[model samples]
Target chain A: MEQWRFIDFGLVDIRDMMAMDEAILKGDGDNTFFFWTPKKSIILGFFQKAEVELDLSKCKDYTITRRISGGGIAFSDDRCRQINYGVVGTIDNDLFPLDIIESYKQVCGVLIDTLVHYGLNAAFRPINDVTVDNKKISGNAQTRWEGKLLQNGTLLLDFDIEEMLRIANIPKEKFLDKKIASIREGLTWLDRELGEQRDMEEVRNVMKKKFEERFHVRLKTGTLSSNEKELTKNFLPKYYSPEWVYR
Target chain B: MEILKTKPGIHKARGGLIRSFVFVENGILKDITISGDFFLFPEEAIFKILENLKGTPVKREELLKNIEDTYAKEKIQSPGTAPSDFTESIMKALEA
Candidate 1:
């Protein structure tokens, strides 16, 4: 089994989480699976126009940052009900197949196996989403920069659709005429599926075990190196700056 | 030649959005700027798409073929957005 690094920095601010991602990708780290969640924030995809995709008036109360990754915006909060993780490394056929789609399939396959371990059935949707009974439980995005790849995503232990709607303009122009029921139909959470709230530590433990078995890798738990810490500190300002968010 | 500003045409594809700003000259795409909430892997594929459409004819079939060819050449992975959706949006802009 190939060995990889596993780092868990719990419940960080959005900026540091963003910086941590870049630090690991910029430096040499064994194919790493890193996990973190922002206390509460709305993260915009790299190319997403904030004015077009979000309900700014409602979001005025929270912190907003744009991620270097690609995909739709996701609303995360202090609720601590969702688990987020990313795989950072160069692709090798031995670990993850080189094709982007296949790589997504591999990572999501690990998630699926994890969910199954929790007694729920989950499947991956094309490109980058995982669904339970066709309702989204996870959304993933990938980026390849300077030959290094990063695929980051979130797995919802539970979510609040009302809160999600408040933060996003996902509703159509005519959607105001309808109720929020359809939005709920599009997404689901593990707690909802299992009919109970799950502890975050429990989820993390299960995820670690699942990833280990699925990838055939012994995850050697490690913390950020001094060099990575220095890099993360440098990236912090940019990640937190309005120039990067609005740029 | 200075290009005139025109209204952009927007289309909702299967899984994302596409907004096309097209400047046509004699049925040729003089300049096109595409921006939307769509997710694309490698992200630079957006610039490549815009670059490939420079000087492409605005005709539906021709534009579709050019877009498809460019996407093929770039090995683009536009998960929810497809070349046909982009071409259709451009055609709508040209027609308008």
Candidate 2:
């Protein structure tokens, strides 16, 4: 059985978080499962333009940044109750598939299992979403560097729908076309589903265990390596610059 | 010389919602920027696709051919998006 390094990097800033994620992908290290939360911020998909996806005037209260992964926009903050986790590793067909869609199924299945352990009726919605009661609880995205792959997902513990809507410029017609009626109808969170706020540490424990059990690996608690730290230092400037975020 | 007009269009593709901001002058695509929640593999290829489409005639057939050529050249592996989906969004922007 392979051994994976598990690091819970709780509550980092959005830019440093992005830099660290990229550093881990590019740096040589053990296959890692990383958990973190960002200080209040809105993260955009790599391809999304800030002007199109965000109401900049209404987003004054939150930091706006773009991640290197391709997917939909997401709002993250510990206060709003969101947890983020990333799985970084080289391509291994037996462990994780090479195909993008198939890989989403493989990684998202772990999330579904974690949610199920908490007694939520969770399911994997393809491309990349984990849903409970047919409403999305998690959205995931991926990016590749050389032979390495980094897939990260946002798990909503308790969502602030109004805040999200205020910052994000989602079209009302988008909901109508999906027959979703309203944005609230299309999203759900762990607290909403369970009727109580789950302890963050407990949730993290469950995810660590689920990941270890499902993949038949031992998760040794570890921190970023020296090389990863150096790479992150080099990458930090790019992530912090307005040129990168607004471009 | 015609004034370049930036027209916006939105389309919900099988993959995800795609938005296109096309700058057209005299029925010629001067520049374009495609943005959306859709996933495109080798993600940087989107820029190349846009760069390649500059100065393309805004007609449906011509737009499709240019985009298709770029898709093929990039060896794009977008799961739910195809060249035609982008072309449709771009065409919508042109018409708008």
Best by DockQ: 2
TM-score of chain B of 2: 0.90
Q: Chain B of candidate 1 versus the native chain B: what TM-score?
A: 0.88
Candidate 2 chain B least-lDDT 10 residues: B1-10
Query: How does model 2 fare in lDDT?
Result: 0.84
What interface RMSD does every candidate have?
A: 4.0, 2.4
Which candidate has the highest lDDT of all? Answer: 2
lDDT of 2 by residue, A1-247 (tens): 6788988888788889989999999898878999988888988899888877887888777777888888888787437578799999777876777888888888888888899998889998877889998888999998887877899998889888887887788876456655787988999888888899989888888888888887789999899999999999999998788887777
lDDT of 1 by residue, A74-143 (tens): 7886687788998887777656767777788888887888888887778888767898877779988787
The lowest-lDDT stretch of 10 consecutive residues in candidate 1 chain A is A171-180
Deviation in Å, model 2, residue A135 alpha carbon: 0.7
Model 2 chain A poorest ten-residue lDDT run: A170-179
lDDT of 2 at B60: 86
TM-score of each: 0.84, 0.95
lDDT of 1: 0.78
- For residue A15, model 1's alpha carbon misses the true position, in angstroms, by 1.7
